[model samples]
Target chain A: MSKAWTFGENMNTDEIIPGRYNITIDPLELAKNVFCEVKPEYVKNAQPGDVIVGGQNFGCGSSREHAPIAIKGSLAKCVIAASFARIFFRNAVNIGLPILECPEAAVGISEGDDVEVNLSTGEIINRTNGRRYQANPLPDFVLKIADAGGIVNFLKMHDIQEVLA
Target chain B: MGTLIEEIFSRRAGGTVQAGEIVLLDVDYIMSHDNTTPLAIKAFREIGKPILDKNKIVLHLDHAYPAPNILAAENHRKILDFVKEQQLPHLFQQGVCHQVMLEEGFVTPGSIIIGADSHSNTYGAMGAFGTGLGSTEIGVAWVTGKCWFKVPETIRVELSGHTQPGVYAKDVMIHIAGLLGMDGGTYRSVEFGGEYIDNLPMHERIIFPNMSTEIGAKCGLIAADDVTIAYLENETPAKGPFERIVPANPRYERVLEIDVSLLAPQVACHPDVDNVKPLMAVEGLEVHEVYIGTCTNARYEDLEIVANILKGRKVNPLTRVIVTPASARIYKKALKNGLIEILIDAGCIVTGAGCGACIGRHGGILAPGERALTTMNRNFVGRMGSPLSEIYLASPATAAATALTGRITDPRGCL
Candidate 1:
């Protein structure tokens, strides 16, 4: 089980990692500052396999993949949101950071609640409350990419031309 | 039968596909800037492949150009070294990546372009299927020249009626943001059509798509028409031949009809782009700085609007006004037309053409507790500097007018 970190609606990329720190592309360095402003203790307190739960339109601003990179670098297992912005969703998938769209899990999961998720089955269980929820499973191709550990790994296994064809 | 995005995707997919279908298609151009290129380069190295087509890749050093710190300098050096190593032909240090892409003729109608920046949707103004991707995706595209996309359902925004004298495209977009909320067009393609969009100049038309990200849209497109062609001919003579695209029987998931005939100047208040209100609601709120630039509204025409508002007038002594042209080309044009002089004479600090101040990497960062009024998009918390500072989004006219009063004043009142 993992701890849940909850955030309100429209949590933007800037809030995830301020643009000032964008000078560095190092994920670990970026991770140290993740949620520094909004949740000052996030980087220090968030443990491996912690799940971030957010309200609607989570990750709504800038296309900085650094946001997801920061979250993943922090060793968070996955992000669960009521809904996600398009680019953020793509960024997370491209980087192999698991994310789910389950409104019930987003609202029902309380901060510091013990949570468990199954990316393949789209199942989220709030161990604290004994409630389970279902998320829309990712498409097969996207799951394939995620399973391979991101688009780069997926590309290594399959020829680009063949993939397009 | 299909929306504009569906048509573009069909051509690339080589088959008729609907909104929910996924297709892998070859991309025409891939762009990345200082903020994203280093990460993309790292991913590209991890992929262990040579660039598939050096000609199709474009890079810029705009986000924190002229290196504000040692890390930025190192990143710039890395991008430069990679560009040299790959013999890439499209490295541009001249301006913001998006504006430079258009000025350099990379964005063509009915083409598919992806960038490592969200505002890549800005290319949709020319009727291209432009969307943003992560640096890793850009790295993958560098090796493969192709990416996958799920054709998005269409949100048809039919804009009618004429904007009032001081009302501008920025206001129209802010109004749309107000109506749609932040995620109104999430995972969808928003196509702006009808009389209002048809009548906007090229510079103005670009604002719609540029700010589309504010509404969580995948892309915001305008069908290629005579206005688009005319702008292309005038601005990008070397651009390749392209066909104008318009959906014959486009299907839409939802339709929003907005009449701008009597619209007032609008502002997106602090911390949220969707938290919009008419100028009257936030009038007289003091601002410490007034910024007029960004891909959203920093075109030469937008500068001209600021010039017209500031001509023979002076900015409030207490307010600091910073104006950045979107590109060096725009800076030169403004210089040639004496807009630069007008801005300077009005006490505005004119910065180099780049993404300066907008991303808060360097120029004009706000101090703690300070408030700013800018013509840029995205007023999210800490967007400009201190987390406690505030950013209010408005038009160039409103920015200039506010610069004169050091407060949020309606441009119409000044006019």
Candidate 2:
């Protein structure tokens, strides 16, 4: 079971990880400062496999992949948002951070609510309320990349030329 | 017929690609700056591959250049080593990546360029299909010389009427951002058109695309026309057989018509780029600092506007003013034109050319409870310094006027 940490719409990358700390790219190091400005206690209280639930355009602003990297490093299982900015979605995929688009789950989930998710089946269960929601399942190619622990590992197994062709 | 993005992607994909289809396309240029290049280098090493084509990769040591801290210095050293090891020929240490990219002639119409920074959309001003990506994707592009893209649905914004004096492109863009909330253009392409855009010079046209990201746009574009061709032929080093690509019969998901005939000078308030209000609403608000620089407005013409306002006036004693030109070339041009002298004479601290203070890595940073008025884009929390500090976004004219008054003053009154 994972606890949901809810946030409002248009939660930007600068809120996730401030630009001042972008000099270091280490995921763990970046994790320490995740939500440091917006939610000062997030890094301290967040547990492994916790979930982040947000309204529209989550992870908006800037192309800093550090935002997703920090969230992944924080041991958050996945981020469920009503929508995501274009660059953030791609960055999450590149880093193997699971994300789902489910307006129902994003709006229904409450802070500290225990939840369960199934990436392959797109099933999201709110254990606290006994509600089940369906998220838009990721594409097959994206699922393949996530399964291999991101594109780098996927590329290690497949030929780049073949993939491009 | 397809939209502008569809046309660009179809040509790159060598097929009839639609908005929703994901396709792998060859990228012409891949750019990374100091803030991201270090991370991309690490990812590239993890891939254990040689750079597929070193010439296609561009590196800039602009963000936090000269190293604000030990970690940043170390990151710069790592990037320098990687550039040398790869024998990369396009490494630049002098200017913001976006400005240098255009000045060096890497941006051409109908070309696809991806950078590891959000404002890569600035290249779209010249009619290129440019967008930002993460470091890992940039690293992968370095290895394969290609990247996948989900062709975005286009939003057509048509601007009409004449822009009044003191109403610049920055004001027009801020007004647009207010009309459309932060997510108005999420994951979509925004194409600016109509008489207003048609009349803007290349420098002014660049702001729309550069600020499109503020509204969550994947890219902001304007079709290449004679003005674009003229700029490329005369201004840039591009010896391009440039292609003028306009949609023959374009389809748009939504169309918005905006009239800027009497648009007022606008400001995007603290903690949100979309919380825009006219200068009358926020006028006389005291500011601790005023910054005039960024990819959005630090071009030569923008400096001239500020210099005209500050030519014989002194900056208010209570406020600190910092001016950073977008590029070294722009800095030289401003110096040659005596704009730097006017700015310096008015008591503004002229800093080196780069993404100075805009990213809060170096240069002027606001303290807690302080407020700043800047010409840069993005006023998200903690963007320019303390999270408790406030940032107001406006044009260089507004910045100059506010700097002179130590408060948010209307540029028209000063003019």
Candidate 3:
């Protein structure tokens, strides 16, 4: 069971990861700086398995890879949003961050609600109401990589990294 | 199944690429700009190659030009350091990559163009297959002359009817983003056409593919017509035959059409592309800044429209309005046309053109609590330097109106 950190609609990458600190290459420093500019509390203290739910086009502007990398580093197991900007979605997947699209979730869930999400089945159960919703589970390929702790590890596990090398 | 541009670029992509389709594509033309080149040059050397073919590449210095950032200035130093070492010839002073390519007579129709910046789709307006890439991937491609692509499905966007005055291409793209919510065209190419698009001026038609990335499409395309030819002739070595591209008999997976005749001011509400609505519905929203420049809408023609509206008017002192042309050429033309004076006299600051305020890269950045109304693509949160500062995405006319009022407004004010 994971607690939902229900946020308002349209939580952008700057709210997730600010841009001023983009020049740095250190991932830990980046993780430390996540959302400190927009939501100061999150960067300083965010529990694991805490999912950030947002509105459409969550990531926009500047093709920065740091946006997704920082979010993943902060231990947001996944980001469930109503929709997403194209580049951010691709970057999230490419870097192995889990971003699921849940269009109606905006109206259904509430802040601080306890929920159970079965990643393999895409089943979301609201602990408060004991109601359940079908999550339209990710395809097998996504699950395989997500299970391997993101795509890079997936590539290493399946020996795909050898090809690029 | 067969997109006109894809059919022409990778002619061999169709038929069948099954469960395991490993294909090698001989990249036609590759491009790199200031920011990505230094790192790319490093990667290429590490990978062991001078470059597969010099002619197949274009090195642009557009990103950090005029106002060189620390990293890009370092890149410029490297470009100068290896000006002859790399044996490259596609270098130019930092300028807008899209306009520079067209003016220099680079990019031909049905050819593939890849650059480090995502908006490289600007060339797709000229009918070239252009897209963005990361530095490492570009460096590898420069050495190998090949890059792998998972063929994307195509979505046909049938645009018909004439636009109401001042409703230009940026409005049309915003309308599309509103219609097909952001993420609607994930991993797809938006093939554009219809009677409405056939007659737009060259600069106006250039806006479609420039911002397709807003809602997420690889590139946008339109069939070549007379307007394209007339514009091509003025440039260097005229382009080859006008490759007329026609939609398949049945047409795209999904067809969405917008009637420009009756459409009114539409705005992409703060934080999302699809948060769009008729302007009358959400008028009077407050804003802190208004920007009028981007690869999408900062051309000479676009500036001419704004200049007409701001001729004698003054922007609200409460609102910081900045207008950046897409290129130095457009800036010069604005000066020639007295558009620059109109902007200055009317309280608009016309700065050197190079993607100003669009990405908030260097020029003007807003504090967290501020809000900005812009004419460039994408109103995604934190897009214009402030995650807390809201951004309202609209047409140049609408942006100008907001500039005058310091609030989200319709440009029908001047009218």
Candidate 4:
């Protein structure tokens, strides 16, 4: 249960992880720079478990996974937007970031509001407003990937080790 | 109990995918622009592995031609350094990756391709599941042949009727995006078809897939056809496997139609490709910049449209316009056609043929609180340089018109 960190709708990847750092490869390095290019001071003042709620077309622009990795690396638990870009959404999941599509939820969740997300039930509860949004639940297979810390690691974790006799 | 959609799902689907689900993916293509190469080169060494496939890799220089910024010039040097060292197959000394890939041949339909730059989905026009990626994921994908993907559901867009005098494919896309809202198509595929789409010029139909990502679709496409064959043979030649793949009319779960005959002038409001309205509705909004570049609409024909508009008149002093061709070849052709001179004589700045404003790598960025009407794609916040800047998406005609008036003006009146 954490207070939600809110932003206006349509918060893009460039706003979430600006282009000045598109060159960097380290996820941790990206985390430090997340929103810094756009907001300049987002990471310095941001707390862990904050949620970025946005409006339509959130995470639009280069299908870069860094957009999500940077946000997740910064320790933000989830990003709830009215909608998510296809590539951005895919990249976020591929990197083990949480993105919730709560079209109506953003209308109610203001900045500095508190919200808790239940991974199992796909529920996001707003503490200040006593509001609840039922987010679209994730696919079972994708959950395994995220649970195992993204796809690359998830593949490593689920190694069945073929025993050829 | 399941149908074709569920079948495409079963092939890659596992676990639960829902609105709140943030799942990991396997990458197919990893692409990079001029700036990211130096760092990507450094990280590749840290990964400590030989490139898995050089042929699959693409290294392009789309930003800063004649060199825009010092950093871009330095980046160009780094890209040349690494591309030569690795013996990469897909290196573009002149064109943007989007045009070069479709021309020189790197994107294979059905393969998932990622780039270090945004708008890599330009390849989706050729039917590849291409998109942008970060330097890290790109570096890793270079080492390992495997990438991740979670099957995304598809949204079908059907187009009907024929084009009116001035409407083009870009307008059609912008018009739809405006209606659907930016996020409406988020996380879906736009499968295009209908009477008009079926007969569109292969090069023209490309505008659909190229700008699909702007409206949030992963890849916008019309199933490959005879027209595609004609274009591929003309653009990319060699004995390769390419078959005409058409989507079954009834198999498409959702269908949308656009009667080109009935459409009018359109514009994507500042900062959002989907914030669209009739161009007439937003008329009179002043513009200080008009950019006629980027992978989405910087095609050769796109240049011709601009040249035609500015042939006889000078641009408005208050408005600064830049036109970057998609490739060196297009540059030469425009020069041959005398379109380049028309642009320059009219005070339109012409840069090298790489992606300029479209990639935000260089050229045509707005100052804080500045406004622009452009023919490029993706007008998100801080996209062009200043976070407070505003951008409106439109056709080359509209862009040229605005360039003449120094604000959002209808192209129909100027000519």
Candidate 5:
């Protein structure tokens, strides 16, 4: 169970991690500024096991990986949204940030609610509200990549690079 | 049975691929710039492996060039050292990554390409499956020479009819953005077809695909034909062999038909790319700056139009006009054709052939409360400097005309 931070739709990349802080590639440094422009209290108030609930089209702009890295670096467990921009979905997978698409969770989960997401079974349980929702299940390959803590780790353990190359 | 994008994926996967199916395809080229290279390097090191093939990778030092400060300078140094240590041969210190990739002939037809920058879709002008990926995925591609992709549903767009004088490809693209909405093409592939596409030159073909990212498209494709072959012959010393693929009884998720003749010089207003209107709708708005350059509209054909408009007339006394070519090659061609001289004689400030002023990192940062009409894509707030500053996206011809009046003006009469 993790607390929830609710946000509106069309939250662009610039609002997630502003371009001004893009000078450094460090994830921890980027973590200090997540949602700096839109939600000033986010960096300070967010906890390690918290969850983010957003409406449609979350992370819509830019192909920057900094957005997901910042969220992961902050130790957030996962992000549950109604829908995600295509690039944001791929970027999250590359960086090993779990994301679940559950429209019910997006609408039903309130701020400070204890939300738990089960990626394999596509289940979302809101302990605070005593409600449950079904999330879209991820494909086997996508789950494999995320469970391995990103593609880099998967490649390292399986020697898939040479096999694929 | 399949669309152009589906067929391309099927050929690469060695079997039939449908929309929503995931497939791993070999990448022909991987491109990155100064801003993204540092992160990719970090990821590549975390993987603890060598790049699959150094020859297929290209690096450019265009963004924040000459170092806005010590931080940027140090990052450039780190990238240079990594390139030297890895013995990578292709590095361009003078051009934007997209332009450099095309000039070096890394983006031929019927190949899969990826870059760290979003404008990588520009390569799809040659019928290639080119798109942008994040730095981490780029790092994965660097090490494995492969990336997984979901076969995106295809939206077939049939372009027809001709534009009046002064109405350029930029106007058509902006109009389409208005029709499709900013996120209409999200998670989809867009392909151009019909007779109007046949009449467009390579310079114009680049814009449709280059601006496809504005609509969140995975890739934008135009099938190869004789025009593509002729363009290759003129641009590169050698051409890669390519056989055009046409799907038999093709199926598209949806089809959109556009007539350029119906378009007036279009402009995307402040804060959004899809907040579009006719040029005349916002004609009287005063402008403080006029910028002409970017991967979208900095081609020789675009500059030729600008030079013709500003050949003898000077820019408005209140407005500042800045011109930057997209690449060193285009700059040299413009110089040889006396376009640069005409621009300078008309009081335009000519800059280097890099992405100057486009990214707001260097060269021209708009002051607070300033308004600019530019030929670049993306006019989001705080995109070019202070959030108070505003940007209007338009064609080079419209930009040039606006420069002469210090206001958003149509290019028809000025030309």
Candidate 6:
């Protein structure tokens, strides 16, 4: 079980990882600055396996893969938002960051709640309030990519030319 | 029944493809810029394969041009080393990748192109399936010459009537973005129809797809017509013939129609592209700076319009105005036409052809609590320097008028 970090809607990429710190593409370097501006105490308070919850339209700006890399590197287990911007959604999948779309979990879960996620079932159980929420399940193809730790690793296991062809 | 996007995918797939279907497409061209190219090159190296085709790849140095600092300079050095080693055919140090791609004839009708930058959709003006992709995807494409796509549903936007004087395509796009919320067209394709689109020149046609990404559309498409043929002949005559894809009895999931004649000079208020309002509604708000450039609105005609509006007039002493030509060629043409001189005489700061101030990196960084009126798209918070500063989006006419008055004044009566 992990504590929750709640955020409001329309949280853009700049806020997640401000453009100023974007000079480096190193995931570990980027992780240090994740949510630095909007949530300065994020690094100090966030423990491993903590979850991030946001309202609608989270990660809605520049197509920076660094945003997900930073989040995943920050030791957050996964992100739960009502909805995500298209490019950000794709980036998360490409980088192996687990994200769920659950409007109920986004609004109902409070800060510091102990929540558990079941990737195969798309279930989010709120142990703090004894509430449950359902997430949109991923397609089998997408799941395989996620399970293999992202597109690059997944590609390593298959003949990209034949699989894509 | 297939939409224009579906038809393009179908043709590429050698069969009939529909919306929501995933297909692997052979990319005609793929590009990456300074900030993203290093990552793509690294990934490409990890693949341990020779590039699928060097001629099909392009590397541009526009994003961090003139390098903001020593670190940025180092990053440029790395990209240059990779390009030299790989023997990439096309490398541009002169202008934004999108503008250079079109002006140099890299884009053709019925082709599929993807770039590391999000605004790559600008190529849709030439009837190509151009869209943005992540650096890894671009890396994968560089190695394999293929990328996957889930064909998106189409939104038919039928524009009718002629544009009024001083009202430009920039205004029409801002109006549409406001109507469709910021994410309204998410994961969909926006196709243009009706008389207004038919009458638009190539520069104006580029504006629709250039800004379509702001509305969250996968890509914006306009079918090739007589104007497209004329543009290709005049701009890229050396290129050979290419097939043009037009949807046969296209089926759209939704349709939106707008009359251009009814649109007034419009502005997307601070912080949101969707918070659009008529110039009349927000007139007289003080502005500290006025910037005109970027792939969205900076072209020869754009500068010409600004020169026409600012002729014999000086910018407000308090309002600093900066004008940038989209490409070096356009800048030379504007100089030949005396537009550059006119702008300089009117107290405008003219700069080289590149993305100067749009990304908040260099040309004109705003101070906290200051405000600017610009022709660049995307005014998200801190997009142009200070997070406390605000950016107002408008057309060249509106930008010129605002520069002269030191306030958000309507451009209709100025000209």
DockQ of 1: 0.79
Per-residue lDDT tens digits for candidate 4, residues B1-415, read 1222223223233533332223344444577876656655664665567887787677777665656666567777777878778888777778777787777766544446777665675766665566555565576677765544444556778788886766778788888887666666565666677788878886577778777776666556566666666677777753357754444323344566667788877888876787888888999998888899877778888899888889988999978889988888889999998999999999999988876776554676678988888887777777787778888889988888788878788777865
lDDT per residue (tens digit) for residues B334-402 in model 3: 899899999899898878867666655566788889988887776756656766777777888888878
Q: Per-residue CA lDDT of candidate 6, range B1-415, in tens?
A: 4788887788889999989887878899998888788778767776676788888898899877889888789889999888888777889988888999988888888789999877888888988888887787788888788888889999999999998898988999999999987788788899987899999999999988988888877889988788887787788643857666787888899999898997899999998899999999999999999999999989999999899999999999988899988888899999998999999999999999888888888889889999999999889878788888999999999999999999998888788
**Candidate 6 regions with alpha-carbon error over 4 angstroms:** A161-165
lDDT of 6 by residue, A1-165 (tens): 788998888788877987767778888788898988678798778998999999887887676777887898899999999988777887788778999999999999988899998867889999999999999987666777788787777666765654433
Residue lDDT tens for model 5, B1-415:
5888888888889998899887888888888888888989988999998889998888999877868888889989999999999999988987778877877777777789998888888888888888988898888888888888899998888999988888988898999888887788888998887888889988998899898888888998888888887877778754756677765577888999987877799999997889999998999899999999888888888999999999889999888899989888899999999999999999899888888888777777789999989999888676677768899999999999999999999999988
Clashing pairs in model 1, backbone N/Cα/C closer than 3 A: B1-B249
Name the weakest run of 10 consecutive residues (lDDT summed) in model 6 chain B: B236-245
lDDT of 3 at B332: 86
Judging by lDDT, tell me the better candidate of 2 and 4: 2
On a 0 to 100 scale, what is the lDDT of residue A92 in model 1? 92
Interface RMSD of each: 1.4, 1.3, 5.1, 5.4, 2.0, 1.7
- Ordered by TM-score, highest first, the candidates read 2, 1, 6, 5, 4, 3
The deviation in Å at residue B126 for candidate 1 is 0.6
DockQ of each: 0.79, 0.79, 0.17, 0.31, 0.53, 0.53
Ten consecutive residues with minimal summed lDDT in candidate 4 chain B? B1-10
In the range A41-144, model 2's lDDT, one tens digit per residue, is 88989999999999999999999999999999999999999988889998998889999999999999999999999877889999999999999988777887
Candidate-wise lDDT, in order: 0.91, 0.91, 0.69, 0.71, 0.86, 0.86
Looking at model 2 chain B, report the run of 10 residues with the lowest lDDT sum.
B1-10
Q: Kindly report, for each predicted structure in the order presented, the TM-score of its chain A compared with the true chain A.
A: 0.95, 0.95, 0.79, 0.85, 0.92, 0.94
**DockQ head-to-head 1 vs 5, winner:** 1
